[model samples]
Target chain A: MVTDKHYAALDQVLELAVLINDDMTRSLAQDGLTVSRTHLLWELRRRGPSTQRDLADALKVSARTVTGLVDGLEATGFVTRQPHPTDRRATLVTFTERGVRTVEEMERGQQEFARLLFAEMPEERLDCFSEALGEILIRLREASRLTDPRGGDQ
Target chain B: MVTDKHYAALDQVLELAVLINDDMTRSLAQDGLTVSRTHLLWELRRRGPSTQRDLADALKVSARTVTGLVDGLEATGFVTRQPHPTDRRATLVTFTERGVRTVEEMERGQQEFARLLFAEMPEERLDCFSEALGEILIRLREASRLTDPRGGDQ
Candidate 1:
């Protein structure tokens, strides 16, 4: 039955996630950064200096949450808040020099990691895998939405 | 490039995990049960009455964690402790009637979920997908190991 196969794949997916998450945590621990913080940095690097409100919107988190993350990152010397050049009411969250270096290094590391994971696999199989992942993601979103308590509102 | 494809797949996988985890949390919250407690119940249903120590080993968690979970489950009427038949120093963690039903329902729900996710996919594609997953998982584990600071110990 596909049930067994599905469960086996799910098991692998869950384990892979755990491995990936643990690896990220261990590596990030060295820099005193967390997943959320790393995400913020990556976003900043990609989008350039962004206001806290803009970051909150892009990250799909609350303004308060963004503020807290920025505060923590600022405290840790990875980011700083500067007065917006064009708007007095707005403030920009800019990366420090070290922050730029760190994000670039992390980006390179991620690329290398992805390459190592997929480089040897035949392109045809990688295509199939990518297709399968897309299909699964669609169903997973539907399933999550169906199960969500605030389903109708979303 | 395969880099883009690999990244697309990774993004999907990460989003899928978030969706799955959120779905589970929402569903479990309805029953006043967290994931770990449900795991304990499921394990109890599968293995019958088990000692807390046995559960700790099976779940790969510390004894203190098991004790806390069992205590919480017991307080919530999902499980109870009984002195082990042969070992005076050990106690068995057995599910209550409600616990049994809950775990069975969760198991059924899991099966249905997997079926819904995979039943429509063609067998050939599913085979390829499974193979790709296995290969990806191997590399993921290796990557995690390589990045892990305590690599040599494992």
Candidate 2:
């Protein structure tokens, strides 16, 4: 049975997630960007230049959806498509200079947010909180894996 | 300065949110529902019944979007529209029997998930973890409010 405290904690986490998402949406909208487009940009930042096919597989989205997202990002000047270095039949998506700077700013903003949350927190309490979060993440991942249909054979 | 521990905790929270969302999406797919549809159902369950205008206001979505979601839910037999008792121009969206049962199941599942996460935890540690979450939630909300354009006048 879940205690009232457990329920409270769970509610807090969910509310925080929703609030974080709303904040992100609003922030991204200022740049005329959507979450899906930012996600594509992030993938490019992490993977360097990538083909649309690879991006589709990485995002678990269809080729058409990836194409649409790439088109939107390219139009927004965040990414550009070029002929693959070797594969004549394929095009690679890469971040523009502005895109790199924007991604770096996003990373800096995330770090600043974390600092705002934890700057005044006691070191010991922060440790405890981190451990609790780490443990919960492990358990949640295991639970999700168990329920995931694609993992049914595992 | 934010420590590596802070970054790890934030990442864990974000990853947990994404995983939770993925799990919910998969579960709702089994019921032919999307997150927006479920949000409507949840609002109905909490508010008893609501008009499309009211739902749009509560959800911060457009009236047309709410209508589309309600139409989909009605087609699935999860909800139905009834004429308002006094307001001739208004119709209230109410859940069907199946809808009520499904909402109850969703609520119970949430409690079960909380229990699974905290059942084995020590009471003292749980208290500490809850306190940490409560504190962070307070800070996050304030931060979001400060950044919210709608709250600028405040």
Candidate 3:
């Protein structure tokens, strides 16, 4: 049985995660972007141009949601959809120069935010924290897969 | 300098966090509730009734957002807003019986989801993962305080 202390700890993690995401979203919003949009841009920057379905899969969002996000980004002149190199039915979504700059700015902000957050922690503790987070993340990912068999199979 | 491996691990943590939140949101939506709304109900159920500003602080959302959410909850007969006992300018929000049931259902879903997610992991590894998550959570909370001085101060 899960104890109250365990529940409290889980609640703290959930609350902190929400707050961190909110701050990141607000920071990105100041640059005329939402976290979702920033994430798409970041993925493109990291993995090069990808089709809409590929992005939807990677982001774990529905294809319709991805289409709407792409439409918004395109309207903002941050991305353009070009014909896929080999698939006639597929379209490759590439970032514009503006998108690149925006993503870089967002990345810089995130890194700075992270650095400031960790500035007070001892280096060893920071290392521990990072490692611990990594382990939990792996567990959570594996767990999420089991709960969503469709997600796991994909 | 952060090693490439460490950086990769951090990226995995970040991605997994997003995915988990998405999964939770979808799960909550299936029960005719959004995570944000259910969060308020859970808070009230755990901590008793609270003012809008207090709820906002606890949820790390803006007061305006909380106001809208409360409005919707009140309309759905899941919550009630009453005058604050001591603060004339504030209104206390509490969960109704329906609200409590809703929160309980959401919690059950979440716990089951977590159980499914970790079923495959060795118990020892699960404990380690939980401990690591707890440590990182503590550090993240401390770090967030430094970056946002106004957070939790109100």
Candidate 4:
């Protein structure tokens, strides 16, 4: 039934996501970075240099959109474009020294933020929560492979 | 140290959020409604007949944004604006018959979505996940109250 507590928890996830997103937006704005921009930077930091096409694929954005993000970041000296060593036609994007610093700062900030949000939560509980979330994520990924726009009939 | 599995879990939560948001966006677009628009509709349905000011507050939007949403809904005969019985200067916003039907459909769609996303989980695990998520929400609400921008940096 819709009144079920489990359903309420699912709804809470959505509500809490909105709140956290607001917080993240404000925090990123202070750094002059949108979440989208920071996300690209984070990806580059994690995966090291990548071609524009690869980034476009990884971020699920259009090639033109990737160019725009890369251009914006490059213009600001947060990233640079280089000819790919393996592929002559494509360009690779990597963090500038400044970009690396921002990624570090963002990562540190996120860690602190997570700790604050989860402070005093017992370890065993978190383990269970983490495992539950992991399993749910796997299920979602699998379910997404099916072609039901309504998510599913079930 | 930062590469710990717990950090990975936290990061997964953000990734999963992006995926879910993308799904919601695509789902809402099919019905000619944006997520923001449907979120307001959902709120109105759950709480019933709120003032524009209250809607703005509840949705965490500006008064002007609320007017725009209400105007759009009103234009489509999905909601109505009428003088408040208690307050002369204020108006109440409530769902029309069409609006109620839309709300019901949206709720059912969301349930189907949730079911698709969480199908086949064991009941005991779901109970644990629900309880864990509930506790995490409480902590998040508590953490949000702190003044420091880095989520209190404590």
Candidate 5:
């Protein structure tokens, strides 16, 4: 039975994500970078630059997420998004001079944030939750993806 | 440590939420309702209408969430927000005639969705996960809510 408590818990997850992003954006402002900015810069450098789609896949994030990151990075002069000449559907994401220099710093900051986020989590449970979450995501993806708006693959 | 798998899982949670919302919105469209609209109408019916802030608190939802709900409901002539003369900042939300008739249908749809969402879950594990999620939400709320951007309760 999915009780009202379950509903509350689900709502909490949504709020928690927003809160986490807000806090990260605020804290990163001191260094002139947001969480999205840092991650995108670091990923671009690590992957030797890539298309937005490839970057999304490599980072295991959504295309919309990558777009948001690129938006922030571009606004901050940390990245440039260029239309890929060979692929009309693709956007090339490459580091700016500033981004190249800051990528290492961003990588370090990313690690620090990750450490802080999981500092109190029990490793065993975190691993279990991660695994469980993976399964749920797969099921959800199957239910919602593969089937297009017309109810079939695009 | 937040490894690649952990990050992947986190991204999955986000995408899953999006997918769940998309599915719900589609399901609700048949009756000229969105998920937030349906939930808000049902809540108002069950809780006997109340101040927006009080309703948000009781539902463990954000003010923004309530605002979105009220936006849809008000647009559809299912609810109204009236200024409280005594409390200058408060807006009381009350169901309209359409809302009263729709509430029962919304409740049924909500239950059907809940059953489908949790059909495969073990009750014991679901309960455990719900508890864990509740704790995470409290920590997130504490970290983010105390320091407001405009530095006001609003």
Candidate 6:
């Protein structure tokens, strides 16, 4: 049986997730970027060039979705798609110099925002909260794997 | 100074939030609904009815976005928009019987999914996890209010 406390906690988790995403998305949009596009750029910027399939798998999105996102990024000159070095069947995506700069700016803004968020909480509570959130994430990822085998295909 | 543990926890929290939302959105899509649209319908079904602006506020979306969503819902005969009884410029949105039934089905599926997510964790761990998540959410929300005065504006 689900207790009231459990229900309340779950609800709060869901709400917080939405609010945080919304805020982040808004922040990115203020700089004329979408979170989805920024996510793709950030991946390339952080991990160096990678194949479309690999990028799709890392982002947990469909290949077609990644293709569309890459198309937009390529059009904007933020990313480039080239033939993979060894895999003729796959294409490699890499960030442009402009994309790298944009990602760095975004990272700075995000870090500042994160610092403000953590600054408000008690140090001990923040530590405990982080640990608990990590544990729950592990459990949820496991549950997702069991129920949704499609992710495993990636 | 942030410890390695803090960084790990933060990354976990961020990744978990993304995965859970993705899974939930996919689950809702399988039922021919988007998470945002389903949220509007659920709120209407539960609260009896509301205006587009009110729904937008409750769902944390823009009124223009709500208008588009409501238009799609109305096109599918899932809901109806009528003039507010006392406010000529405002409109009230009420879910149709079909909408209510669809939302109830969605809720049932979500509840079952949540149950499966929590089933593997021990009771004590679950309690600790939930409490920690709740505290973080509260602190995040409060911090956001301080940093962004328009954070929750719809």
Q: Point to the candidate with the largest lDDT.
A: 2
Query: Taking the tens digit of each residue's C-alpha lDDT, what string does model 6 give over B1-154?
Result: 5445555666776787787786777677754568778788888877787998888888767899999999888988789998999999999998888887888787787676667556556676667667666666777776666656565522
Query: Which portion of correct inter-chain contacts appears in model 1?
Result: 0.62
Candidate 6's DockQ: 0.41
TM-score of each: 0.85, 0.92, 0.72, 0.83, 0.61, 0.80
Candidate 4 local Cα displacement, residue A145, angstroms: 3.3
DockQ for candidate 5: 0.35
Better of 3 and 4 by lDDT: 4
DockQ of candidate 3? 0.27
User: lDDT at A30 for candidate 3?
Assistant: 56
Give the per-residue lDDT digits (tens) of candidate 1, residues A52-124: 9999877768899999999889999999999999999999999999898888888787777678778888989
TM-score of chain B of 3: 0.80
Q: What lDDT does each candidate get?
A: 0.81, 0.83, 0.72, 0.76, 0.67, 0.75
lDDT of 4 by residue, A1-154 (tens): 3336557657876756765766677678744578778778877887899998988877767889889988888987899999988879999998889998988898789988777645556677767777878887776666554644544433
Give the deviation of candidate 3 from the true structure as CA RMSD. Answer: 4.5
Clashing pairs in 1: none
Error of 1 at B78 (Å): 1.3
lDDT of 2: 0.83
Off by over 4 Å in 2: A150-154, B150-154
Tell me which of candidates 2 and 5 scores higher on TM-score.
Answer: 2
Give the alpha carbon lDDT tens digit for every residue of B1-154 in model 4: 3336557657667756765766677767744577888888988987899999998877767899999998888887889999999999999999889889888888888788667545566667777777777776676666565543545333
Q: What lDDT tens digits, residue by residue, belong to model 3 across residues A30-100?
A: 54578788888887887899999999998878999999999999999899999998999999999889888
Q: TM-score for candidate 1, please give it.
A: 0.85
